[model samples]
Target: MEEGAKHVVTGGGPQSGHCRSVSLICRPLGMKPHVVIEGVEKREDLGSMGNTLLYRMAGSKLYLAPQENYESFKRRVRKMKQYVSDTYGEKCYCIPVGGATGKAVFAFISLFDELLQQGLHDRFDDIVVTVATGGTSLGLAVANYLTGSKLGVHAVTIALRKEEIYENMDKLLKELGIDSVKSADILDIIEGYVGERYGTATEEVLSFVTEVSSSTGILLDPYYTGKGTMGMVGELVNNPSRFKGKRILFIHTGGIFGLFNGEMDRVINKEKAVTNDITPWLDENVSPVSIEQ
Candidate 1:
C-alpha cells in the first residue's frame, strides 16, 4: 500500500454510534502494521438530530448542526477521537474535508477528546493535517485549537471559491469559539490536480482511481476521493521530507455515493464505447441467416 492513501476492508456491518465499520490495515514497506483500525463509520444520525437547537445557538445557518443534538456535538467529537486512538495509535489524527455530510466535525471533536484522555497535552509539534472547503475544515480547525496542537492543515477544496473558503473558514472558527486556527493553502498544495470544474474528474485523478481499484480493489468517490487522493499524492511528491521513510495515514471518510449519478454515467458510457471498439471482431464471428423479404 502507498503512503498517504486510504485503504478499506470489506465485510463489516455498521457499528453503534458509527455510520459504518471497516478495517484499515496499514503496513509500511518493511515494517509491521504501523496503523490499524478495526471499525470506522460515518454517523448518519447527525441529520435527524434536529436543526432548531443549532439555529438557536449559532443562528439560522445552513451549515451549522441542527439544534437537537447540536450540544452533543462535543461528545461526538470525543467519541471519534477515542475510536481512532483506541484502534490505531495516539499519533493518529482524523483528517477529513468539510463537505455536505457534516460528519467530519464529529470525527475532529472525537480526536480532541481522545488526546485529552491519553494525557498527551503538549504534543502539538508540526502535525500534518488536511481540510476541505466546508464545515469539516472549520470543525477541524476548532478541534485543533482546543487541543492547542500546532497543525499544518491542507485545506483541500474544489467547490467554495478560494476567497469564499477563506472567509467561511474564518467565520466558522470564530463561531466554534476557537480563536487561533492556522491554515495553509490547499490550492497551492494541489494546483494542477483540481481539473476544469468543481467536482469534475481530472486525468491524473482518474488514473489514480483506476490504479487503486486495479491494484488494491478499493473504490474511491469521484469528487472528494479523486480530489483528496490527488492532494495527498501531490503532497507526498512535493514535500517528500515530511513523510520520507515514515508511516503516514490518510483518513478515508466514506462517500461512495458521490461516484454515482452523472459522473458515473459518463465513465460507464466511455468504458462501453471502448469495449465496443475493441470487440468488433466478435460481431463478424456471429453469422446470421438471411430472411426473405
Candidate 2:
C-alpha cells in the first residue's frame, strides 16, 4: 500500500442477482486519485458476466515508483552483508536474480545504484536468471535496460515453457530499445531441480525455511524467500563447482505475511488441536491435601 493509492469499491446497490463488481486500487506515482463513475440500466443485463459498471480512472497510470523497492533492497543487502561478515569473518557479494515479485526487480536495481555509488560496479556483475516466472523477469529486464549497467545479464530460464520467457524478454527489450540481452539455458546453472508444480513450495524450500527460522528466528516468506532459497540451494548443491567456494548471498525479500490467512489458521488448528489446561474448583475451596511426609 504505497502513498496516494486509493482503494475504490464498485458494487451493486444491495440488490440484483448479477452482483458482479470489480474494484481497483491503483496509485500512480505522484498523481491524485481520479475516480471514473459509470451507471448501467437494468435493461442492459446481458448475462452474469456483462451486467456491471465498468469504472475506469483516467491519468492513474503515471504513479509507478520504483524507489520503494530500491530502498528495501538496499536495507536488506546491507543487513545481509553485515550478517555474513560478522558471522563468517569474511566479506561476500550479492547478485540480483529471479522475478520482480516481493520487490525483487526494485531491489536489484537499487543494489546496482548503491554499487555504483560505492564504486563496486567494477567488482560485481548483475545477471537476470529466469525462474520460469514472468513478472519479476520482465521487471529485471526492463530495469537492466533502463539503468544501463555494464554488468553481464544472462537470462537463464528453465526448460519448462521457456519460450514464453524468451518471447516476453525480447518484447520488453525491444520496447526499451535494448538489443543486447542474451538468453541462456538455466539448466546448466540451476540444474533441473524444479518439481511437478510451477510455483508450488518444494520440500527443500520448506525444510530450509523451517531450519532458518529454528536457528535464526527469522521467518522467510513462502513465495519469494522460500522458493528463491530453494533455487539458490539447488544451484549451490548441484553446481558447486561453478561457485568454487565463492560467497553466494541469497536476497531474502520480505513477504512473510503471505503465509498467513484465515484458512491457514483453520488448517493448523485442525492438524494440532489447542488445549487449555483448566482445573475446576468447588466454591467451597477444598484445600489441596498436602502429602505430609
Candidate 3:
C-alpha cells in the first residue's frame, strides 16, 4: 500500500515501543523487506520486548545498528542507509518526530472534521496527548492550525524537557510546510509527568497504572499511556473547577509493553493464560454501556 515501505528504519530507543511496532509492519503489512534498526540507547537491559520480537520475526534481512544514542547511531548506521528512503533518500519508514508531522496532522484533521459534522466537537474543551518523540503531539498542533479548531491541544510530555519539546514541535511545524504559525494560540505542553528517567517508573506511576486499569479496563503500557493518563488525571483532579462540566479528550498512545514490576503487569500477562479458569465469572451480571455526556 505504501512505497519505500520495503525498508524499515527506526531509532531503537529503549525508552519506547514505537520502533518495535514499526518493525512488524515490514512483513505482514506488505512485502518482505530489509529492516535496519538503530539501537540508540544501550542500557544493561540491552534490548526491549519489542526488539526481541523484531529479531525473531525479521530474520536475516534485519540489520542492527547498536550504539549508545543519537550521535553514535548516526555515525554507525545513518550514513550507510542513504538508499533506504525513496522520499528523503536518507530516512527509513518511520521518522517518529519530524518525518511524521505532516502526515499525522493531516490525518487528525480528517477525524476532527467528521466529529464536527456529527456535532461531537462541541463537547471537548481541551485535548491531551502523550508526548515522547513529539510526532503525535505536534500532529495535533498542525491539525489545530489547519482547521482553526478552538479546542486546546495539550501534550503530556513523557521524556523530554518542556523547552525541548516545544522547540521540536516548532521545528516539525516548519518541516510540515505549515510555517509562521503561533504555537501559543494552538498548543500547550505540560511537563509534569516525567517522574524519573525514561523507562524508569516510580512507585506512584505503578500505583496510578493499577488504579486506572482496575477502574477502566484500559491497558496502559508504562512508557506512554500510563504516564500520559497520570498527567491528565492529576490536572483534572487538582483544578476541578477549571474543567468542571467540560470534556477533555485524552489521547491514549497505544503500545504493547505489558509493564513490569507492577500488579497490573502481572495480571495483564497472566490473565490470558488463566482465562478458562475464570469461566464462571465470565457470565456475571454486566450492564450495557451508553455514550456519556
Candidate 4:
C-alpha cells in the first residue's frame, strides 16, 4: 500500500479476481504487478481466460505454482518479491491470495458501517454473500456484532470447508485483537453449494445465471455470484417457513468477467447468431451524401 513501492506481488488461481484487481490498481500507481498463479507450471499452460486474460492485459508479470503445493506457492511469491527488490531496488508489496488478510477485513467492516448509516439494516433480515476467502463475510459479522445489529450474516462457501472457513475467520479475528468471540457464533457458513468443485459449473447453475442476467440485467459469474445466488435460492426453497416474510440482501460481489472463464456462453446461447444483411433495409430514395471535411 506504500506509495513509494515500485512493484506489487500477489498470488491466486488463474480465474482469481484478486489477481486481476491487484494488477489493475498497480498500473495507475506506477507499480508493476507480479502475479503467481496456481494449478499450472508455466504461462503457456495458463490459458487466456477471464481473470487470467485481464491480468495479462494489465501488464502483470506472471509466475506459475503447483496446484496443491502451498509451500511452493509461498516460495514463488517470495522469490518474485525478492527478485523485484534486487533488480529494481524497491520493496514489493505482497498481497495474499484473494487479498484475504487481517487488515483487509476492516474494509468490509467499514462497508457494514456505511450500510448501517444508510439504514439498510432495517430493510433486510439476512445478508447473503459468497465466501471465497472469508474476509468479507468475517468483516460483516464483526461489524454486525460490534454494531449490535440483528441481521443474520449467511456466507455460502464456494471452495473451502466450513471448518477451514472458520479457521481463516478466527485468525483474522485474533489479528484484530479480539479473542473472546468465535467466528462460527457470528457467521452462518452454509454448505453444499460448491458444485463440481471450485471453478467448475453445473448446467443448472449456468441456466440460473443466464436467467438472472437476462431478467435483472445483473450479471452473475458461475464461480462466485451465480453459485451464491443459487445457494440463496435453494435456502429459500428448502426452508420457506424460516424466511417467509423476511427480506434478504444478497451481495453481488463483482466477478462479471468470470462468466467468460468457462462455458457460460454455451448456456446463454445454444448456437451462434447468423449474420444478417442490411442492404434490403437501406432506402433507395435517399442518395448517399459524402460531406468531406
Give candidate 4 misplaced runs (Cα > 4 Å).
Answer: 1-3, 69-80, 240-245, 271-293
lDDT of 2 by residue, 138-243 (tens): 5544554566634444333332345555554455445545576643322122434345443334545555666666567877644345555556666656655554
lDDT by residue for model 4 (1-293), tens: 54567899998778888789999999998889999888788657788888889999999888777776444655677677778788788888777777887899999999998888888766888888999888889999899888774888889988788998898789888999989799998888888999977767888888888778767888898888899999888988896554424698888788888888767766654543121112332466876443321
Ranking by lDDT: 4, 3, 1, 2
TM-score of 2: 0.45
Q: Better model by lDDT, 2 or 4?
A: 4
Cα lDDT tens digits for candidate 3, 205-281: 77677667677788787767888888888877885453424688887767645363233444434433321133323
**36, model 4: CA deviation in Å?**
1.0
Weakest ten-residue segment in model 4 by summed lDDT: 272-281
- TM-scores for all predictions: 0.47, 0.45, 0.71, 0.85
Error of 1 at 25 (Å): 30
Q: Which model scores highest in TM-score?
A: 4
Q: Which residue pairs collide in model 2, if any?
A: 28-63, 29-63, 29-64, 99-136, 100-136
Which of candidates 1 and 3 reaches a greater TM-score?
A: 3
